[model samples]
Structure formats: structure tokens, C-alpha cells
Target chain A: MTGPRIALAVLWKDIRLDLRTRDRLGHMAVFSALVVVLLSIALPTPTAETRPWLPVLLWVVLLFASLLGLTRSLQTETEEGALAVLTLAPCDRGWVFLGKGAANLIALLGIEVWTAGLFSVFLGLAWGPALPEAIWAGLLGGVGLAALGTMLTTMATSARFREFLLPVLLFPLALPVLVIASRATAEALDGRSVPGLWWGALALYDWVFVVIPYLTFDYLLED
Target chain B: MSAVETQEVEKRYGPVRALRDVSFSVPEGTVTLVAGPNGAGKSTLLRILACLTRPTSGLIRILGRDPFRKDGPALRSELGWLGPEPGLYADLTVEENLAFVARLHGSDSGRVESVLEELGLAAMRHRRARTLSQGYRRRTGLARALLHQPRILLLDEPWNGLDEEASERLTKVLQRHRARGGTVLVAAHAVPAARELADQVLRLEQGVLRMLPGGPREETHG
Candidate 1:
């Protein structure tokens, strides 16, 4: 199979597995949504002045929730020893990373959408003209997060304490993505223009992560 | 040329060495049995040969190509590997799992059916792997490994969960594969069926590999 075809096959398998089990995506949606609801109840009602914190809260929730989806995606491979089969497939193993990242991009987008809706409902914030730009930022941010998450998660799979190690390794490497994404999001939510610098950082982070994983995925699979 | 060749292969995890200076070769059209006690590096050796694991320091050539090189994927395509874990997606049906793997190999649907029937798993094709018995699950992995018609087979414990009939079927399959000039490297216990089929027997203990004299039929593990 060609690279794209192999990647699509892997994506199809992941989608099929999720469809049948509903294990990872369900956990991600519920865990993230719960964070929003719990915070809404715990925090004081937001006014125009304090509402910028909502964007930060939203990114935080989505960030941690993404951890669950990312880890589980590779966890299934390790738990079932399917990683061997994937690495053995007649294609660049990076294709597996691409397929995984794509699947995660889809799942994270779903979580982000629901979380955004819930954020608006709970915080009583009006999206207004910022909605489109915010959506754009979120999409861009998702690509970077998904790409980085896919690579780090695979690295953590062979770790002794994968559960704890994944976050430690991911959170540090993910800081740049989180910082840029959150700032752009805050600017959009505050009805200010997002700087080109922020958007450029997000795009650059996404491209670097996507390319690095493709180049280095073979080493991660190697023993 | 040999289907598999390894020279001074060693694998290390932290301070522990799983394989040490392991070297062996399996020429074409023969079945080589790798016998070892648990934790004796059988799985690690097989993993290296299958290109799923790279040795810390060594040379490995599968089908005369270095699996660590750029053409590794193409080399892997010509090799079939079954690890100790069954290596299947439990949520997928037997047929779905087989079909998905076949597609990854760029094979058509017809190959899937033939493998299913060959393993006597045709009737259970639609059943989810999680619902099947252990034997059936192993058969599913075996079928997937064989579906692409690889030139070399690297199987780790192919008989561990199989029933007598299924074991017989696998033996026959190996015999046929060898008759057609395919190479097989099997890591297994000293089962009679596997022993009878092996042209060579290797024993591994404490990260060392030794060739047993008198071939598989006459060799006995201590």
C-alpha cells in the first residue's frame, strides 16, 4: 500500500475500534465536560472583567482531556501488542503516527466543540464576532496539540510508568503549544485582535511537530 | 541466501541485558525451532528478526536486507511475525481484523477468505475476538500473519494456546510453507509436532544461544 492508503487503513481501524468500544472518546468528553461544569459551579459568576480567564480554563480542560485520548490510543496498541503488527506493516511506520494523529485530531475537535458550547452556556459569555476567529484558533491549536500528543504518547508507551510519565513528558513539551493557543484564544475571547506572531507560532509548532514525528517515529518503535 | 542472519546481537534495557552476542541463521526452505525457558531471550530474538525490535548492537539481515535500513518496511512486508501477545484488535470481528491487516499488506479480499478457511476460522469470521476462546484468538493472529503470503515467518509460541486439531493444522501449514521454499523461525516449547517439523533446534539460556546437535527430532531440552 501507498503511504496515504496505509495511513487511511490505520485511521479506519482506530475509528472502527472506537466505534465498537466507545472507551476513549467517551472518557475524554465526559472528563472534559465535567471539568467545565465543576468549575462553573465552584467559581464566582464571571463578569466582563474576569471573563478572560474562561479561555484559559477552556484550554486547560481541553489540554488534560486530550491527554486521555492520546494515551489511550497508544495504550491499546501496547495492551494488545498490536504495536508489533503496526510496525511490521509494509510501510513507513510514520504512517502509523499520521493515522494516529489524524484520529486524535478528529476526537480532540469533537471534545473541543462540546467543551466550547458548554463553556459558553455555563459562563454566559457571548461569542459575537470573535466566534469565527476563536474557532480558527482552536482548529489550529488542535493540530499542534494532536501532533505533539501523538509523538509523546508513543514515546511514553514503552516507559515504566506510562500513566505518570506521559503527562510529565507531554506537559513540558506541550507548553509552547498551550501558551500560544491560550493567548490567541484569550485575545479572541476578549474581543481584541490576535497577533500574527501568536498565529505564526501555532502554525510553526504544528509543522515542526508533524514533520519531526514523521522523521523520527521509527526510532520510537525500535527497541 | 539465508532468510534471517544475526551476528553478535545484543539488547539492553537499562542495566539488564536481555540478549548477549546472539548469532544464528536460518536458510531458505527450513523450519528452525528456538527452544528456551521463560526469560531466555526467545521473544527478544524473534522480535529482532521480525524487525519489531532493534538490537542494541548487532547486524540483522532478513531476506538479505537490513531491517534497520530505509527499505525495512519493504523487507518486513515479505516477513510474517506472530508475537506472544496474539497482536489483534479485540473489538474487531475475526474477519475484520484479518481484512484490515490484509489491506495494510495491499492484498485483496480474496486472500482474507482463503486464510480464514485455511485456519478453519471461516464460520467464526463475524465473531468479535473478545468473545472467542483463546485458541480462536491465536488462530486469528496466525491467519493474519500468513494472509500476505510472506516469504519468511517469525512465530513466537505458535502452539501455546492451540488445541490438538489446530496445532496439527499449523504444522501442516508450516510444512507446506517450507516445501514451497519459505523460511520459518519458531520460538516455542518442545512440543512434538513443532519438533518433528523443525530442521534445526536452538536453545537459549540466560541471554546465550546454543545449537542443539542431531537436529530437532533427537534433541532434548534440559
Candidate 2:
């Protein structure tokens, strides 16, 4: 099969599985909702001083929520040694990586939208004014997270402590994405234009992760 | 020419050697039975041959091409592997699983129906894999492996969960494959039917490989 065809096959398969089982996405959604509910109850009323911190808080929630989904993304593939079937793809195994990463990207994007809505409903946050820039930040941040998370998850899938290993490996590498994304989000919330530097940084981070995984998946998918 | 060949193929998992200088060759249009006790490296050898894992220090060629090189992915397309696990998606129905594999191999979607019928899985095509019995799961897995009509089949304990009828059906499938000039390498503890159909018999003990005499084809190897 051609590269894109392989990727599409994997993408559709994962999506279909996710829809059928609702295991990964369902867990992530519930976790995010519970965390948001706790934050709404525990935090002091949203004041002008604390309002700026919301962007950081939002990104942090996303990171953790993404961790929930990313950790389980390969469960289906690993369940019955199905990963062996994926390794048999006729194209570069990198195409398989792309397919998996794309599926994760879609899932993360869905969670981002859900979390944003939850924040608006419970935290009394207004997103109307910041919609465009916030979307750009969310898109770039989601891409970086999905690419890095998918690659690291695959690498750690066979590890004994994979559940613990993913976060340890992910948090450090994902710091830049969180920093730049939160800053952009903060500016957008304040109705200020996000500087091009943050956008470039997010884009660069995404590119590096996507390219590295694409180049190294052949080895990552092997024993 | 040999369809599968390995030279000094050794596999090590931290201090423990799973395969030790195991070398063997399987000719085209033949069925080779590899028998061994549990933890006898039967699965490891099959995984190596299937290109699922690399040999620590050896050479492996599938259809005359190094399966660990740049050609490995393309070469893997011609191979159908059924490992200890069925390698299926539990939530997907039997038909969905087979269709997915067919697409991965770029095979005609029509092959999915044909394989289901051939494997007697058509009746349960709409059933989720997780809901099927073990025997049916194995049949579905075999169907997935054969979906693309691969030139080589690497099956590990394929008859484990098969009923007598399913076993007979599998025997026929192997016969048909051999008749079509395909190569088959099956790893198991002991399957009388497999022995009856085998062109060669190789025994693996403690990571060592030896050819059993009296087979139609035999080769001396370490």
C-alpha cells in the first residue's frame, strides 16, 4: 500500500475503534470534567489577578487530560499483538506513526473544545473575544502534544512501567509547548494579538516531533 | 530457492539466550513444522522469521531479501503471521477486522468476504472479536492473515484453540496454500496433523535447532 493509504487505513481503524469502545476518549472526557469541577469549587472566585493564571491552568489541564488519552492510545494495538499487523504495512512504518499521531491529534482537539466549553460554563470565562487566537494556540499546541505523545507512547508501550514512564518522558519535552501555548492563550484572552514568535516556536516544536517520529518509527515499532 | 533462510540467527533477552545460532532454511511450496516445549524459543524463532523482531547477531532473508533492511516493510507485505495472540481489535466485528487488514495490504475489499466464507467466519462476521469464542478468534485471525494472499505464512501454535472440525479445516487450508506453491512455517508443541502434512520437521530445544530424520526434506544445522 502507498504511504498515505496506509496512514488513512490506520487512522480510520483507530477512529472506528475509539467510537465503538469509547474507552480512551471517554476516560479523558470524564477526567477532564472532574478536574474542572474540582477547580471550580476549590479555587477562589476568579479575580482580575487570578484571571491571568487561567491560561496556564487551562494548558495544564489539557496536558494532564491528554496524558490520560495518550497513555491508552495504543491499548488496542497492543491488546492482541495487533501492532505486529501494523508493522506489516507495505509502506514505511513511519506512515503508521503518522496515522496513529493523526488519530491522537483529532482526539486531543475534541477534548480541547470540550474543556474550553466546560471552562466557559463553570468558570464563567468568556471566549468570544479570544476565539480566533485561542483556536490557533489550541491547534498548534494540540499538534505538538499529539506528535510528541504518540511517539513517546509507542516507545514506552513495551516498557514494564509504561503508565508511569509516559508522563516522566512527556512532561519534560512538552514544557515548551505548554509555555508558548499558555502565553499565546493568555494574550488572546486579554484581546491582544499573539506575537509571531510564539506561533513560530509552536510550529517548530510540532515539526521536530512529527519529523523525528516519522524517521524513527521503523525502529520504534520493532522489538 | 528457499523462501525463508536464517544463518546463525541468535536472539538474546538480557543474559538469557532465546535462540542460539539457530540456522535453517525452508523451501518454497513446503510446510515446515517447528516443535518445542514451552519457553523453548518457538515463538521467538517465529517472530524473527516474521520480521517482528530482529536477530541479535545473524542474517535473515525472506524471499531472498534481507527482512531487516530498507526492503523490510515492503517484504513484510508478502508475509502473513499469526502469533500466539490473534492480533485483532476486540471492539471491531470479525468482518471489520478482516476488512481493515485487507485495506492495510491494499488488497481488494472483496477478499474480506471470501476469507470469511473460507474460514467459516461468515456466520459470525458481524460479531465483535471480544465476544467470540477462542476457536472462532483463531479462525478470524487466520482469515486476517490470509486476507492478502501472502506468499509466505508464519503461524505460531495456530491449532491451539481449534476444535477437531476447525483443525481439519485448517489442515485443508494449509494443503491448499502448499498446492498453490506458498511456503508455510508452523511452530507448535505437537500437532499430529501438522506432522502428517510437514515436508520438513525441525525441533528446537533450549534455543538449539536440529533437523528430525525421516522427513521428506531435512537439513543439518546447529
Candidate 3:
């Protein structure tokens, strides 16, 4: 009925749909844990010297895991011709984009909440005065990710190697989210003072970068 | 009320022109079947009207509101569309899928169950969309298009994959809607159900749209 109400409806449908069979959160959790294990073994951080690196590494792994989920939506969108149905609706295509972005942002945040908690415990990483700061970092990262991921996923539906294309294309667009998340995370985890500039920097990228994807999403969804 | 109007509508993909100087108007509350061979721009015209595709050039309005002014959602609040092979989320049960769209349009989920029951889809409420046959899935799309009680309905190839019963059901629904002063536009592969229901027929070919000579007449296409 209302704009946000419509968005929530889409989000609920996606969540309920995912819950019945695939378990998006569970899949992301497992994938994230696997990445965490791999990172732990690959880097040889026996003395906890790589502790500051924990925040960044885990976030990177989680980012990949979220991408894994985002990439998977392509098959469903194509098979269902959901894009066609969505485009054909009397509502604005931007609402469709925004609805999807909000859904993805929430889902990614769900994964981050769980993965961050477990990752901290396993990595023996401590969050000091920057504990709350690290979370804001995570939220910004998730917001930026949802904006770009939905835009690209719309394109990947038209592509042949969508899964491969998502990460390959995303690797560049996502560098900003990565740099900000990791730097703020590194500062927070190491018990260093979180810089005022980094927060502003992440927020700037969030607003500025999102506008491009938001304004252009409808074109990508079209034939 | 005029249901739709387009002036100098042209859509192009780079150098190729898909729609050329398409100007047309349809009287309100009529079943205007857009018929043509493949690549006749029928689908393109429907997309522009549905506000899904923007014309590379021209002015168009749905119920008199400019559809391409970047204020589309405002216009979309009252529009309904059924695309060819409208895909539902495979993992969702039929009921869940229905309720989801209903609520998305700010309607009640209970109405979804009732609508499904009315459409004889009650028993399969828990069934996944991927599990339904082609005909039933199209029914799901039809149900969603009918949600929100839209004043305008745009269906692209509405009769594909339907059996006699489903076809009859859809015809009845359209007849009821038309009787209520609602406007219906159908892009059908063949003439559907009763010939008496159409107020006008349109033939699309070679990037042009024109009215068929006979009003609401039966057309037998081989």
C-alpha cells in the first residue's frame, strides 16, 4: 500500500521463499565459516600476530559469501521470468530495484551479525572502544554491497557466465566498500582509535556510489 | 475516459529502430487485442504502455500521466501487467507467493487465499511455483495481475499454455473486469474465447500499429 510497505512485502516474500528450501542464512553461514577456516590455515597466525588482520579477513570472507547468495538469484530471476513480471507491473521499476536492495541489505546484515559473532570468537579477536565503530563499518559495507549487487545481478541475468561475471565485475566496484570496512575494522580490532575521516569516507562512498546503481538499475533489468 | 495515448513514440536499440513514429489512442474499457507476426513490435508497444520500457523518443501517457518522467512508481500504483511466462519464486508455496504480491501492493494476504480459492487454486496452496505445470503458473501470474484491483490491465500473451478450463476461467475474469468499466489490453497469439468481448482489434506489423478494419471481429490466423 505504502512505498516502504511494498518494499517490506517484497523482502518478506524473498525471505519466506528462501527459508522454505535453500536457507540463505544457513548457506551463507557455512560458506563464511569455511572461508574463515581457510584463512586461518593459509595465513599461519599462530601467535595472534595477525589479530588485526582478523577483522579484515573475516569481513572479506563474509563479503564473498554474500556475493555467493547474490549471484544465485540470477537463475531464479531468469527461470521465473521474474524480471519480466517485475518490469510489467504498474509500479515503478525503481521500487522494484529499491525493494530488492532493501531485501539484500537485510539478508546480508543477517549474515554479518552471525558471521561476525562467530568469527570473533574463533579468531580470538577483541573489539575494544571500537566495538560499536566496527559494526557501523559492517552496516555501511552491507549497504554499499546491496546497492551494487542488485544492479549487477540485474545485468548478470542477461549474461552467460553470471556467477563468474558477478565477482569479476564486482571486484572493482566493491573495492571502496572493502577498503573502508577493512581499514576501520583494522583500526577497531587493533584497539586503535577509529578515525573520523574513515567514517565520513565510507558514508560518502555509500551515498555517492549508490546513486549510480539506483538510477541505472531499471535499464539493466530490461531486455 | 481514454485508456491510453502515445504520440510520436519511437524506441531504438542503437542503430536499429524497433518502433517507428507510433501514434495511437484506444477508447477506455475496451479489449484491444494487439496481433501481429513475430517481431511486429507488439511486445515493444505493450512494454512502453506498461511503463516497463522507455521510448527512445516520443511522448506517452497512461491514464494521462507521463509514464517516462522518472516518476513511474507514482503512475504504477494503479497499473497491472501480465508478462509472457511471468515467473514466480520457485521455492515459495502458491499461497505464500500470492500473499506476498498482495501485501506488496498493500492489500491483504487473506485476499490472496480467497482469490486462489476462487480461481480453484486452494488445494495447491502449499505447492511450489517450480512444481506447477505451465498452465497453472500462468494462472498465478494472472492472479497477481488482478491484485490491487487495477483500473488498467495489460496482459502479454495471456492465453499461452492454458487448457480449456483455465482459458474459460480467464475469459470470465476479463469479462467481469470489462463489465466493471476497467480497461483491458491483451496481446494474444490467437483470438481468445468469445469474439463478442472485444471493442477493438489492433494489428501490429513491421514496426507500425494500426486498427483492424472490422470492429472486434474474429480473425483466423493459420
The digit string of per-residue lDDT tens for model 3 on A14-42 reads 66656666666667878988777676567
A13, model 3: CA deviation in Å? 2.3
Per-residue C-alpha lDDT of model 1 across residues B1-222, encoded as one tens digit per residue: 988888899999779899988877778888988888999999988988888778899999887889899879889889999887778887889999888898888988899999999999999999988899989989999998999999999999999889999999999999999999998989888688878888888889888886543444555443
Which regions of candidate 3 fall more than 4 Å away from where they truly are? A46-50, A74-78, A84-98, A121-123, A127-130, A155-165, A210-223, B108-110, B192-196, B210-214, B218-222
Q: Please write out the lDDT profile of model 2 over residues B44-137, one tens digit for every residue.
A: 9999888887889999989999988998877988899999899999899999999999889889989998999899998999999999999999
lDDT of 1 by residue, A1-223 (tens): 4778889998999888887788989999889778888998999989778888888888888889999998788777877578887888788888988998898898899899988888888877677888888888889989989999988888887788888988988888888877888778788878899998888888998999999999999988765
Docking quality (DockQ) of candidate 3? 0.51
List per-candidate RMSD values in Å: 1.9, 1.5, 3.3
- Cα lDDT, all candidates: 0.86, 0.90, 0.75
Question: What's each prediction's clash count?
Answer: 0, 0, 3
Of 1 and 2, the candidate ranking higher by DockQ: 2
Candidates sorted by lDDT, descending order? Answer: 2, 1, 3
Model 2 lDDT tens row, A1-223: 4999999999999899889888989998998899889999999999988998888988999999999898777787888788888988888989999999999999999999999998888888899989999999999999999999999999997899988899999999999999999999989998899999889999999999999999999889888
List residue ranges in candidate 2 displaced over 4 A: B212-222
Question: Residue B68 lDDT in model 2?
Answer: 89
